[model samples]
Target: MARPVWSGTLTFGLVSLPVQMFTATDSHTVRFHQLQRGTSDRVRNKRVNERTGEEVPLDEVVKAFDDGDEYVLVEPEELDDIAPGRSRTLEITGFVDLRDVEPIFFDRTYFLGPKGKEYTKVYALLEKALGEAGAAGIATFVMRNHQYLVAVRAEAGLLTLHTLHWADEIRDPRREIDNLPGRTKVTDRELKMARQLVDTLRIDWKPEDFHDTYQERVTALIEAKRTGKSVEKAEPPAESTNVVDLMDALRASVDRAKKPSDQPSGHGGKKRANSGDTSPPTHIRDAAAKRRSGGGGRRKGGGAGSSKGASLDTLTKAELYRRATEASVPGRSSMNRGELVDALRGARQHRATS
Candidate 1:
């Protein structure tokens, strides 16, 4: 069982409910240790005094604010003395519609559970009330000497507390960003094409359909190096679209989007066949044979097929990369535009011959 990070009494108006807060998320990122360049010795960091050149214990380290001419030192106990007294209490000052809160303000999340079985009824009642009202309780409390602005709301029959950033903490993008395209005008045709492209690429929001491909590649690279094998390098990013080619680019993108992807939807490729059926079905094998023998009818434009009159040279580098991926071309990632075109041409000729 997981332990609670905090135990406190949540209060709003005259009602008080005892609750325990548990962290709601965990990170699965891979971590690496620092080491010497040519040796296996681990490199570590230590707090040290500049004047004495000696390592200092954590308890002896004090925070110091640099003034123009002097340093103002503060002890850990001094900070504790100035912390708010409501450290063990989460008092909701007011409730507001959940939609009123911007996504940028929300930070970390914690699950709030009843402290004891006897408090379950009160907890459930509050959760139900919040859910029905579509509101979040605004609260402020201190934890580990830091005061946090938080929102408490009902989620899936339980109370969830989300830490929020102070209003001033959010940066004004208009002021901070220098290259924003403010008041840029677009032609009606361009806007229509852009909307068409968006519609063509529309997909349902399914978080499970996505994976950390970069992290997976990193793991693959590590394993490949461990086994004395070479790993494929990631392809270079495509060039930015020129303003003169904006319409053409949008049209091409829309056309590409309309075509079904040759790659798998999620991380991995096609599912493995069952043990009973080790080989592909008869129709699949016949289709493969037809493709290899060039007996299938000529595919239309924008397909990876090397049918008569299909021009691989006219396709963009990104398009060529896609075709290379579908054809399982070797060293496609590190190939340039011309090289990709040549490689695709070679692959097509080889397919036709074999």
Candidate 2:
């Protein structure tokens, strides 16, 4: 079993329960070591006295605050002494509807479990109540000498705690961002076409259908380099759309989205003939033929390109991303608009030759 990161007593009103919190997620990003350029020697970092130019032991290190001229040093024990009982207790102030809390306030999540078998009944009761009420318990607790605001709620028959950002920490977007589009206007025709495009492209939510394609490519790059092979360079991003041709772009997008099979399978790349699907549907082949025959002309904001042509350059980043997803292009997730177009073009050429 995995070890819990924190163990503490959770109290709400007259009820108290002992619980252990475990990390709910893990990262799979590739890490690289720092090394000297053109040399095999590894680079390392060390704590050293700047004045004396000598390495300092970790035990001798103390927290310090710079008061303009001089540094105020303080021991770790001094900070702990000031924390009081917050380090061991998680007291819930009250329960509130989970939907009321904005998503921006939420941060890290942790799984909560009863500390022992004896406390299972109490844990189950709380979990049931939270689930039925669709509410979360707001609480404040101290861990590792830092305080955090958290929300405790039931998830998949168990309790989960999510760290929340303090109200003052969230920045106002209107104030932070420049050139805000407060009230943009659009024609009814353009709006209708946009709605049609949206309807055509709507899909069921399936998180398993997506993945960290960029990381997968990073791993592949490492393997290829290890084998003395060259990696392919990605294409540049697409140009911004011209608002003058918004309706044409929307119409073209809707036409493309109508053919769901044009999108790539979840397995990445085209489906194999052995999978009992020999080729695309008749309608898809007809549409591709039509596009190839110059029936699909370039518009100001349209990315409508035939599989055999340079029209891919006219497509927006979002359009390119969709096409990349359909073609199962590797590393598409991390790619900019230009990269997506380049990858899609490469995929098309590969399919044609094969």
Per-residue accuracy of model 1 over 1-354 as CA lDDT, tens digit each: 789998889999999999999999987677889999999999999998999989999988788999989999988778777766547889999999999999999999999999999999999999999999999999998888789999999999999999999999999999999999999999999999999977766665545444555666678778999999987665444455557667756766665444444455333432211111111122233344454567756456423333336478665555566666566666554455667789888988999999
Stretches of model 2 off by over 4 angstroms after superposition: 261-304, 308-354
- CA deviation > 4 Å runs, candidate 1: 261-354
Q: Please, what are the lDDT tens digits per residue for candidate 2 over residues 1-354?
A: 999999999999999999999999999999999999999999999999999999999999999999999999988778777774648888999999999999999999999999999999999999999999999999998889888899999999999999999999999999999888789887899888888876665665555545665676689789989999987643344334457545545655566555544755555433211211112232243444445576755434433333433378765455466567667776555565557678887998999999
Query: Measured by C-alpha RMSD in angstroms, how accurate is candidate 2?
Result: 7.9
Window of ten residues with lowest summed lDDT in model 1:
271-280
Most TM-score-accurate candidate? 2
- TM-scores, each model vs. reference: 0.74, 0.77
Task: State the C-alpha lDDT per candidate.
Answer: 0.75, 0.75
